[model samples]
Target chain A: MEKPVVDQAEALRKRAASRRRRRILLYVAAVLAAFYSFWPVMVMGLEGYNIDLGVIIAGEAFKTTTLYIGGLPVNVKAIIPTAYYYLQDLGLEAYPRLVANTLIVAGLSIGLSLAVGIPVAYVLARIEVRGRSLISYLLLALRTMSQFVVIVPLYIAYSRLGLYDTFTGIALAEQLIILAVVVWMLRGFFSDIPRDIYEAATVFGKNEWQVFRRVVFPMVIPGVVVTTMFALVLLWNEFLIADTLTGVATRTAMVGVWEGMSINQLSFNALAWDSLNAAGFLAYIPAIVVVLLIRRYLARGFSLGAAR
Target chain B: MGAETRQGRRARESRRWYLLFIPLFVVVGFVEIYPLIESLYISLTNLNGGASLSNYVTMVTTPTFWNALNISLLYSLSSTILAVLIGIGLTFILTQELKGKGIFEAIYILPLAAAPIVVGVLYSPSSVWDDIQQFFHFILHQPYFNELTPSFYFPVMFFSDAWEWSPLIMLVALSIVNSASKEVYEAAELHGASALQKFRMVTLPAVFRSPVMQFVVVLRFIDAMRAFEVPLAWTNWLGYTNTLGSPVDTISLYLYKLLYSSSLGFPLGVVSAVAVSLFVVTLVGALVLLRLMKAVGG
Candidate 1:
């Protein structure tokens, strides 16, 4: 009634073969997606080589070098590490300082937000706070508000207060961006604790602060750590606030790279492309390392704790 | 009587926790809300010392302002839709039983770490575009598309955006898929549901059922609406008849131009007006999209 046994076996084999084929296809697609995701980074990472080579060739050692293909002026610049080192010697002296500015600003902002945000999140999550929903919505709205809306006024205020171009000034302005993220993500983390645990801690005659310190805070340490690193990456990559607020001494590496790009593109004597690209790559090293390390937490972080 | 007093005391105790919110409220209020209010006030006043609606009038009458709005809408919609679709496709591929899944996931998330400006810098015409042009010119004997046309910059912007943001949606959707019970898939297969049917009725529903997906779409759309760094960085800054409004200038870039462009004399009132209008538009767009999602989900 089910058909011949041999025929049934053949049908199962065919289905298995198709399944294998489909699996192969999906693997190929995933590989392609990975490539697509980091393609620009790879390009940016390699671009320095081209510029460095150009620098070397432009020097006295390679003045006669001219590349042509089919009588067309086609200069195929190759990767030269020595040229990058040379450019690094000349053009990248300020890179270390810019990177330091970025780290200091990002660290200060993260510390400020976390110290401030963790408590607010705790209160909202566990306490019977009034207007919790209103506060929540306000934070969400703040997240979507354009940076320029506030930057205009802040620019005026910072200039008048002599806070313009200072690290503290830049960090203060950045709270508009990072604070909402901290509160939202940590609120999600705090809310994940069971009501029973909170109640049980309260039953032990512990005050709210005591219970939070001994119990819930320790429980969400992992989440807090992840959130800190995540905020660091966001603050590190932030351009508008830092670009607008910072001057020469306080310019974060991101703004530095941006200025480098502008200068390279506009100026007749371009800054070595290799040096700029290298600076660009170096600017995001912490971000790249942190993101990869926290890949497991990415779903939770990206969803702002909407997902388990 | 004792219970009533205890209840009141507990309520008061909990109210004290609200003080914990003060630090955040103070910082955000000073830096964000105050500036926002100041911006609104500035928008309604004139730089020459008189309050007027002239800033709004000037903004609304500008052709470039209208052009920027159109570009923002188109860019936000098309790029977000494309990214979400690609994200969904990626979720399916990634959920497959494959070797090296971890490594691939790590690679996929790398773009999210790159700043928007970095993406723009990397993919600028002088760099990546030139490479592509050279490839075609050498291998296919095609003419180089060297003109800084909309045809070139817009696609690069969209692609860079997708490259950066698609991973966000993927991570959200992938978590949903991973969290789904194995029993559901087994049950579907037992019912002789084909692969397509399983994906349609099972995977798709599981992901779309979450409000997170809607939030992500809104996030992507609103962020794209404020597209600045990518377009700003993509342009050859001092070339081609523009310093700010170039091959593509969304509303934010236009505001930057208004604020910083020497020809405009750094018109703060006009810039504030444009920013206010942009914020209103973004909020309305987000609310409408959220409402649409709710309707669809219902």
Candidate 2:
């Protein structure tokens, strides 16, 4: 008995030591991976700040001094108002409109996706229809089709249909990508709802539509919200379709940034750098805000889709 | 008579449910399918709008198409492989017992939320490229490491894509790992399985068994095959050396150049042919991926 007890204690201690070592190893690996992944963003953020403040920390021009604020030594530096310079280069009047246009395009695209996607997802989830798998495959194909491939014909079609450069046209073009994702994600959510709830509602003399409206729809509100958020993020970050389809009237902030870079390249204009970085910063802000706000939902949404 | 009527009503109701699909089908058909058909038709015709096999013949014969195709394959294969490895590794590490795992996981996935364009700009010659060059030069202490070359572009593009997409794979892996039955793991442990054995037997198989994992793998493959924004932005910054046989011009970028470049001025027929070819390639690639996954019991 004594020998068995001693052996058990020894095994327990060994297990505890191994577990501790594994935990330490995991933490170290996670931190390193996180750093590798986020280093680029950090570099970009720092670059943006340096440009916006007209301070080159890497250069000898950067100066630091200790300031006595609230009886504490605080690091302070001379900073130029590069924001004003950026604004001047960007043409203060054009900047707000550019931001507004990006917002409008993102908003309209999300709206269009939701309006068309929910009903279709409902059918895909609830109704046992013939050729459901075929529809799913079609949606997947649409999702996989390179925007470049579709944009070619769509460009010609848009120009012919008088839809080019219009908000509605751009929004519709954005829908090509957003719709597939919305439908697929929403379908996942809708299917996750317990079938017994829908059956119970139907047995109470509710029509299929009524059951959808009263029982299924409410249950998937969280899903809709998350899906919409995901779609919004995708649209807001969208550059390809918006770049190809939109003209002067409907150019988004992303396009503005791209054009700024192009102008700098083509003309070797120095001021364009300031404007480009500023525009890049502006374009990134909403996505950052959205990610921060909906981080949990975004994680849940991605995992949920994968779970299906 | 009553039973027949009930069956008929049930049939009618199910049929009406399909009516819900009509609006979606119309929009997709009008926006997606119709254009695709029109494009395919254009691909099969000559400049004079007459039916011709010239475009297809040219696409097959042209070295430029093959070069672009090769570049695209390289980009997609390298990026997808690296991303999946990193993603799976991160998933395994993250699932281990660690403090502040949530924070680490959140930060790891931040790139997913970022726009590809933004990621492109961030990694382009303007921002992190300089830092990367400097870091590399310092490590190697070689003059050759200082300049960004065609070889450098591959890794840059690969890292940018992997950064943005690895999180997606991680998400899928995590969900699969988390949802795995604890009993199964315990059973493996009870069998006196080593850590490596447990992982190989229980964890890896379980994760791969999920259909969602298979879907993600296939989707990532397809997406990588069509990589556009990052490479485009990178090349744009690097000054558009997207000539017919250029090293870094991906298939989509090549197609974009064909359509947009004033000097090239490719005819619509040829452009459409290339587009159709790209679509077919994606489809075939997807099918192959699915088959591979199935073969692996994933």
Candidate 3:
């Protein structure tokens, strides 16, 4: 009780040091996080190097998913459950068609995203007409909802329209999901076109359509490239819709991973962990490299669009 | 040619060009608008194949629904806070004018191209990260995770989810901070402001909304709530991961069940009610968030 020293400065230093450590942890976490998230690309490498990896992976998938009843483990013979699979018996094993079909769906989504996205963006951004705010908000809200909301209604609607399990239906669904993003991003470009240039073009006796082709269209080329690349990267990673919408021969890359997971039981060892990990990596490699190539938009500062 | 007639001819041509937008609207309306409205209608009526108010009533009182709501809330809140902290922290460091900022940025967006399902698997502690954790198993045995036994695996998943999105948050925060006027910072420095003082008064007050910027990072979390692929694939819709909203059971998942099982007498009325509730909750959240963005932006 005799001494009363208020060493406030010392306390401040400790707080500062601790705060610095916390920040360092986040930085370290970001770096390690990058590594951890991308670890699946390693699996894609494994597939490229060896054809036998499929059996090894399939064999491993079987071990993880096999269950026991009343403490007796299920036999491996029944674990694979389908011996009639000519690959499992006669043994050419890996299905190339599975990979190709998924690529078809992904390709269609990219095409439609750009094809439709380019024009809607031009109109929304340049026209500046009625209901623009509402349109922008609609775009924002649509992107936020998961595809789960639309699955049943769309399934019913598609069945009515004869779209179930067809490539056209899946591509249409993919474009629907990504349309809002494309429009939102593209509108910014459209609005950024200087009005005076359009006015100058119109003064030359060029009509509105001529002005669009001559002035505004040429100005937003960079925006088109950025949006197209970004759209491709996003559409490629889409999984939930692809999982529910496609069927046997039409299944996409992500659905292949999902189907593989459905077959795997989580409780086991070297096999379950490695093979699924491998398949997931295979699905992610192309997507990762493409995005990294055009990362500027990914890093660009928050741009106020007067829209979002 | 008469001038008025020429203008009229041009106007007709312009209108035709606008008609090109019709196909775009068709795709948008067919895929986006109609299905959205159909879902809204489905959410209103009890959807158990035969039709009745009973499924909606049961859903309103269901404990599982409450758990999903709570899990979503926890995920949104904690994940939002962690994202903001990670974002603001790294962005603060980036503000130091470091040389490798461009490379640092590339590293951050790499995960955007990654599939959520793949992220889910990499985060699957048993398979992808166990090798890393085997190293940690020696130093600190995580007993706090023992309460759920199976959740012992959750730490890795949590880290993975946080890792995947932290860069996104960082990128957003960096944008706002970088846009701040340098004059204000110079004035603070001349006044002998400590680094912390510069951060508090000069930084936070000037760019008061960086935290909200970081929160937009959770748009993915909201999206994740209904995404069944990863949670279903990893947890197999188990009691712990989606106990509140099991795979095929969350309002979103329930919609899928109702759609596919409509043949099996799935309730359309219940599906519709839950879907409507999800739409309303999301609409309200979006409105609140927008309002907040405007306020803080000012």
Candidate 4:
């Protein structure tokens, strides 16, 4: 008996060492690969910082043949040189409006999503619903369908309903992709909490709404923020829907980049390259800000398949 | 405490909880199921390109669907394996007591956050990656990089995407790896066990079945394969933009054009069918891969 126990201990000990070494190696590999992936944007960012930003913006303006940013040539060209162009650029209809447009869409999408997600999540977390497994997995299945696959039908459907080219259209479309995911992630987090917490709420005379607002909401706040970040980035960066559902009037940053590239009329100078990079670099800011703000949410589970 | 009152109270509780599902049911029914059903109706009908799915059926039955589907499968499998292998590698690296670990993690996760289309635009196959492509071209003595031909294009794309998403896989794996017990390692060392043997016997058995952890890693690259934006955009960035806007295009891109077309040539019926098929595959792939990864370790 002692020999068998000793042998088991020895075998377990050996395995632990190998696992630690392997884990160490894995982290090193991740760090290096991460540096490699980020190198391009770093280069783009540095290029914009060292050179004339206005010229860069100007270069993109005239450079891409397909970029139909403005009907007026002067309007496109003159806006690049202002001293406060980055923030001021937003107001020019071409830049700031698009930024604001993206924000508005992101805000509305997050709002609409939470309105539905919280209740669904609350039930999944707290209630003993029938068909729970079926419901949970079905939502996952619906969400697993890539956004591109469904964009066309939704676009055509929305267009038919005259909701095409609108924020509501895209927000509704996004629900198809991320809403279920948010619920799934939050449900996992919510489920882990002891039911006795809710029982205690009941003993304290808290109604469902009061319990949710006071007890559940604060505990899940981190998850919600992270979920919102995921939702924001998903809607902000989604391409198929943007390309099909909305036109230039409501072009998101991605559309701006796509429309620019498709037009491709660069003047072969550093300025054009810089502006192109600037726009591309600026395009990443919303994603960066959202993730950084809710870095905790991004740090864990909601992103396993998509958020990562 | 009577049976009748108890049953009635249980019924009342359920009704309240069930009401919460109203929003879920409505959203799922409209946004997800409706379009899916509508797409099924389109796939079977004959309403595209001056003909019905006769035109559509011919196209669906053509060698193209099989070919693209094969490419998608290849892309997904290849990327998934790459992400997993690379993810595990990075997890090993992350376990080291290295400086700047936080920065490294941030760098690794950036791609997961950025939209694929934007990646496509940045890495645009049309004219994107020319700088890096030119380097590889010089090394291999291939002239294809200069003109950005199809033969030279796909390799560059594969390199760019793998580079983009592989870090994410590692982050997922590392999260699991990080949570592992340290005392287990000290015990193994005290017994004088070897490093490779320790991992083989202990670490693999423990974390391998972690579904939330593994799914988070593998699910990403599988999703990457269905991607229309990133590969197409990067190829175009190299200057042959709009090359993929074709009937024989990616299933998603194909559906995209059909929906947005000015000519109304699309079979809405066929598009819906494709969407349904898309939903099924996404679900199945996630399930299958989840099972496969566990089997690989278990």
Give the number of the best model, judged by lDDT: 1
Report model 1's interface C-alpha RMSD after superposition on the true interface residues. 3.9
lDDT of 3: 0.58
Candidate 1 vs candidate 2: the TM-score winner is 1
Task: Compose the digit string of candidate 3's lDDT tens values, residues A24-78.
Answer: 7656755664554345444333432322233443344334444343355755532
Q: Is candidate 2 or candidate 4 better by lDDT?
A: 2
Q: Report how closely model 4 matches the true complex, as a DockQ value.
A: 0.36
Q: What would the per-residue lDDT of candidate 4 be over residues A161-263, giving only the tens digit for each residue?
A: 9888788876777676578767766776676578899899989999889998899889988777777777887778777666667775666777776565455
Give me the candidate number with maximum DockQ: 1
| Candidate 2 positional error at A248, Å | 1.1
Give the poorly placed runs of model 4, Cα more than 4 Å off: A1-31, A47-92, A265-271, A299-308, B1-4, B47-56, B124-128, B133-152, B191-207, B234-249, B257-273, B286-298
Better of 1 and 3 by TM-score: 1
What are the fnat scores of the candidates, in the order listed? Answer: 0.70, 0.52, 0.39, 0.44
Q: What DockQ does candidate 1 score?
A: 0.56
lDDT of 1 by residue, B268-294 (tens): 788899999888877676565445434
lDDT of each: 0.76, 0.74, 0.58, 0.62
Candidate 4 lDDT (Cα, 0 to 1): 0.62
- State each candidate's clash count: 1, 0, 19, 71
